[model samples]
Target chain A: MQKLTFPRMGESWRTFKMLLEDLGNEVVVPPRPSKRTLDLGVRYSPEFACFPLKILTGTYLEAIEMGADTIVTSGGIGPCRAGEYAMLHHKILADLGHNIKMVVFEPPRFYPFNFIKNVYILNRARHSIRGIIALIKKAWRKLQALDNAEKLSHVIRPRELITGTTTRVYRKGLEWIDQAYTNEQIIDAETAALEALRNVPQNPEAEVLRVGIVGEIYVLLEPASNLEIEETLGNLGVEVERSMFLTGWTRDNTWTETTEGMTVKAAAEPYLPELVGGHGRDSIGNTILCAKRGFDGMIQLAPFTCIPEIVARTILPKVSRDYDIPVLTFFLDEQTGKAGMTTRLEAFVDLMRRKKHFRQGNGLLTG
Target chain B: MKAYLGIDVGSVSINIVVLNEAGEVITGLYLRTKGRPIEVIQEGLKQTAESIPPDVKIAGVGSTGSGRYLAGIMVGADVIKNEITAHAVAASMVIPDVQTVFEIGGQDSKIIIMRHGIVTDFAMNTVCAAGTGSFLDQQASRLNIPISQFGELALKSTSQVRIAGRCTVFAESDMIHKQQMGHQIPDIINGLCEALVRNYLNNVGKGKEILPPIAFQGGVAANVGIKAAFEKALGFPIIIPKYFNVMGAIGAAQIACEEVSRKGETSFKGFQITNLPYRTGSFECDGCSNVCEVVEIFEGEKVIGRWGSRCSKWDITGENK
Candidate 1:
């Protein structure tokens, strides 16, 4: 059996574990992403590269050093920088004198020869369908459980608490879920984990304003991208409801719904009707959905040079006006500072509270 | 009367433009996305609903930008097009012979080359930050100045200082060094703007066939210093359209109009999209060597949309299986 190693993105650990378990091979867990990983990435990568590219470069390098023979990565063909990340990373790694074979899953367009090569890889792996299905089911169950647990924790945790424990439990639950085979086992593990986590006791009367976060997956999920915006928001007594979670994004990307009704019910409205080539649809749809859910405000966070989120920013004002909600946009890069962001968030929240108070005073609270 | 709704969801903001059937912008809303695109769209829609006349019929909807897929789903957009196409359409509507377009938004910057009223080639900066609105905003904040005042400050400069503007880090350090060396604030600011223009030209505008009749749009076009610097560098007066900030939305709306006019119908999901229960989830795909982290959206029991599939195996057919 060929030793397969995968680069770590958010929540990728769980998926890799499950895949290795199914393949009857020992999974070599790469080290958690850290500044060292970033440093190594920067050292080996070309300057002016995007954050994801730098991180992936580091991950691949680390995995190769750990004796992993094959590395897998995804590719895209779009206006977004991600479309070129795979090729660039390949060149960087090759130039760095690493000979580990890379398997890049090609996007819909661009580089026709690469696309054909990817098709061959998929066809060769056709025999692994059962394992894939089982792995996906297990991964889905774990993710759903983790999401539910985290959501509950947000409602119950102390106002000052970062809910890092919830994230920790979620990670553990995912680990257990990956190891579990049967549905019953997965459920059993989830229930036990949920019960144990609930028993830990949290401040029941915590009052935190909910803030919905929507934007590119990297900026939303990666802590460094948005200067740990979720943590910052949480610290400011704002419960963060990020629109893009690893589980949902993966399911939507992989699962095909048979019924139109199912599709309508399960899929986000903005991304529906068609896959329109970028995160623009998801960002806009998620923004509207978040507003309707009574979030106090919306925050659209993106990288310094993200194209899609800029488009979302252009139209968010109408959404804010229609929903009577406030939306703040934050564009982050390596140069962004903590103080500036905090000030902006503080001003936004203060305005929101003032508006709420004014409405209550006017007896306009009733819809 | 038929109305059209156009939404542009960019990296830094979400803009909405409502147009009458006659193709004139009736009302436009510009708001920052602030990390919640879903809420932004909903809020934008609600505002449009309240501001526009109740009797005005929304006959078509269009979405563009990085978030167009999401925006289309949110507004049930009748047409979804790329930013270049949408921008081109809108630019053409405003300036028929728009030979070049220099768009600097909050996050990214793009240079569109057009010949004979058609896009010939284009280049975009998705990696650098020197010429973006956010960069200027950061520099302004660092200087303890309002972003709105940045342009005026640059204009006030009597002397030009050269600051490294190829990247954000180097630019900041260079500015700090110049400031410590007793350089006036205006000079430093103007130098920064000049550096940004130089960086943009070297990066995004490199090797492109730049021509006259160029129109500058997007949020960054609001900066007079950058605009002036562009003119100085290009040796041509760059036209700043009245609706520069919302040009993407206008373009999206124009595309929507074309789609609706051509089809004679619309696929807009109507206002009910505001009421739908939507959820998102993501999981890593270890099916093959490629571990694709797929994002899925659910309304309830049904799966409506999916993305983050690098191979297009999951997205091309819209079928999970």
Candidate 2:
């Protein structure tokens, strides 16, 4: 049997990658996603496909074309359409005449059998303790770097002129971390990149409006999914506070202590009560939290066929009413374009500015 | 004297309820949405306004449902709540000890679990159309039977027939196969009711700790066949409130009454809102990687509302204020 390995991006990705590598397989480390990678993903994927689908599909296809096989990915089994993506991708690959064995990591409640099967696969990997420790350390370094880079970007990008420079350096740093053999080397590369990026000049006239970004996790992270919404907001003179991040997501799943033992419910309870069958809980939580945190407004981004976000759409108006905050939900898919979205954002920002001015002038008279 | 108004706008139906200062429903209207929420709401409001006495003043308005926001804006709602909270409130008002709520509406279904008059847990099905009223309406039309009489006909079944109700496609095919196998119409109808009940139980009601005193509302509650099926399956009589079809509206109205009495004011735009020109359109925002499709709602030429934004960057009214 041929051995195959997976590249870990965050927490699970690191553990899984190590387990695979320890199994004595030729591991393929996918390049950290950059503008080029996302562009490739968008170009190759079907229009109207979810953002994550486009990016992951691009990664898998790119890896495959690079002579890699035995793809492993996580699986979900709820009302959300995400769980079915793996199977659909598998079929797509098979129909394209690619003979690859796609392994899916399932959630505990949905597929108990898959849990045992995953354990068996991990056990097959010869290096039990040593390999696991190495992977954990590598993953920690990567996560810390990514988190620091994202946080710094948020602070530095509040001004306009230096935004592009920071992003460029950040991407380069990620690439270096991915290729780094030693943890110390990875940390050093990340710090050096951050320092260089921070040296760029920022716009003095940028008006920072605290904006909240909410919606499906993949679309929120993958620039391709949201059509580079965060970047656009940054350029438009708005400070984007994204509600989803790799660190929070991992904490919600793997580390119960970090999440205060609330498990899935704890992470989701603030947004939505019980999984409304999709990212509905997240949407609800983000909306309420954004309002409570005194965010000027919130945006909900999701795919067209997303059931959970749709449910969130129905409930958001109520949230808006209760908090007296305005929430706009954006549905994305393959067919979304740039020009129209920009116009809308321009109009929305203009409206917010006008309202802010009015409220400031009139005190309590305006709507 | 204060009054409260509630509006429930669903995909298939629009329900309006008016309650007096005492929080008792005085007049109610239920109309089919017929795929036109804006139009139906307008007509329903017009009719409701006419039915009410001129002296009866609306002190507060509340809205609930998938279309709650739009309805809230149109009616100048003081409170907007989800169907779960609204239903629980209405059910508790009538059946104080109501432990379960089985609400199957036109396009969706929900199971509300209550303990001592408070909503403890709830589950809703917005994706699947298997157990919804729209499914029953489609089946009734396919069978060339009036929807109103379809439920009664289902109750007349003498023998049981099995019909797959997991999905609409599977259920329709199963029904055709059963009909071809010489099963009686009532038996097939009974089978469908059973299948729908079974599907709901397996999907929405799965692992739910259902207690007695279950109240079945929503449009599907009109179906005696489904009621019998539920009773047969659960071995307990599911109570259907008097305002079965408009419980959400009733609940909203009750909530409005409470809200206004506490606040001592009304924000209703009045029945004149019917004359307001409202238009909606979608546009993709290409500000960055998050090319969000923003939906803009305009009143005449002015953009009154904007939604479908991934970042609150678009809607100005929601920005800082």
Candidate 3:
């Protein structure tokens, strides 16, 4: 069996690990990307490559260094830069003298044969179709559990009386979920962890603000790259709701499952008119939904020079005016300073708080 | 007899202002920063102390501009704000119904859109000198005229001369080429002014609605040529407040006053800090791949403040963690 590895994008890492491990392949998990990881990516990556691409390359290099002989990553199609990442990554790694097997899963319609062949290779340990089906079911259950626990953390963190308590509990919950081998254990751990989170002292009467965070998936999910915006917002007594979840996105993309029925494309139809590549449409749709749901404000986080996000940014002001909601957009780069970020956040929160107060005074609060 | 002190330390200039409880400017001073923020601030403070009445107490202190953090720590400011907020606040204070503000500083420029006295939208120039005062200063020197007289020269233009003001390099070359063409100096100067206003509206003010009751203030507000150019371009005269050049400092003072009222106390270090043996030093921390340059400020042998690290491992204050 080949040693397989994948970059830690979000909760997707655990799902991939379970899937590959169940298939009898030795899965090597790269440590979470850090400053060192970013440095490795910066050192070898093309100067003009997007921030997420550089980080992904860095993770691959780290995984290879950790003795992983095979790389499995998703591939995009069309105008999005993501489509070229896998091929460029393979070439770059080879140039750096690391010869590793690379498997990129493109959309089934685009490369069905290659996708099936890759699956067959991964299923070397348990070749039976029934075994593969059962294995996938278990992994899917784990993904749900992981997503639920993460969602709970986002809600609880802002209302917690003690600073960092919810975060600590969430970290422990993640570890518990990671260690669970069976579907039953995963469900058990998820329930017990959420219960533990409930026990954390929380201020029931605390006047908290709800902020919806929407933007590029990688930047939104990766805490280090975004300077831990969710944690910072939570600290400032704001409840954060992410517009994207890894499990939901992956499931929807793979199985065409429409849980909400209200797709981002549909929501953004009036404003965006057409889908531009990347998360631009999603950002607009999510922000509009957040406003309709009575969120006090919205924050858009995207990498500097991200074209799709820039388009979304230009249109956000009109949305803000229409919805009577405030939106703050931050363009992150290597030179982004924490001080500047904090100042902007502080000002934005202040604006939202005042707006909420003014609206409440005008008797607009739903009784 | 209580007043708030506001300090605006920017790349090219440092402005210090004193404001009383009525939000009236008591005294204001503008000085060139010249790459020495600490020294310039101290000098400004010394001059402020000497100018102001002895009985007036400093109730609060605020710092704004790019070096806001450093100035905030140095002065023990009660409020530290960004230039956008400061500019908006000052503009709104001067003209209560101000809907738009165009602030062009020494090396930076910004546009603020206001609604009912609240800053609703804003944009700042991203590392571009084309729409800022520095470019005008450079051109003034290159044309063998003092910066103070540059605006007057611009006002004397007889014919329209177009100067490309996309980038600083191209603008300089374009200016020289126009000069070789024998267009009068004033025409070139006026053209440069119009070009700058055009660049500002195209870039910083891009996609932003430019509503009426606009107030233009900054270090660059003193340039009547730019003001006239803006008036011509927007087809409306802009309100340049009496304390135009020192608006950022005034805004900082206003925010500081509000902060003091809310907190019921002040963190102001007092003007006597001018006499203190204060110094700043920085060292690169190799503990992580980030290579954060940790800057530390000292009051004699005692380390006062530290910042610039992504992680606060080297922060001596113990507050960051």
Off by over 4 Å in 2: A1-55, A58-142, A145-367, B261-264, B316-321
TM per candidate comes to: 0.51, 0.59, 0.89
**Global lDDT of each model?**
0.70, 0.72, 0.83
For model 2 chain B, the run of ten residues with the poorest summed lDDT: B312-321
Q: Which stretch of 10 consecutive residues in model 1 chain A shows the poorest summed lDDT?
A: A358-367
The DockQ of predicted model 1 stands at 0.02
Evaluation by TM-score, superior candidate among 2 and 3: 3
lDDT of 2 by residue, A1-367 (tens): 4435343243234334544564556666654444455676677666666667766766776677777777777787677777887787787767767787777777655567886576456555555566655765676666667677666666666674733565665567666655554678768877776886577687667666777888887777656456678767666666788777776765555424344224434544644677676567767776776777787778888877677887787777667667756565677765565543554454345434434545466421101
Candidate 1: residue A317 Cα off by (Å): 39
Best by TM-score: 3
Report the C-alpha lDDT of model 3 over A1-367, residue by residue, as the tens digit: 5899986776668888988988988999866767778888889988777788788888888888878999988887755687788899999999999998888888766577877888887887856878788888889888888888888888888788867789888879888988999888988988988898888899999778999999988888877788888887887788899988876676656645565525667778889976677788889998888889999999999987788898999999888889877888888766566766776776676567656766667321110
Off by over 4 Å in 1: A1-367, B316-321
Candidate number with the higher DockQ (1 or 3): 3
State which candidate has the highest DockQ.
3
Ranking according to TM-score, highest score first: 3, 2, 1
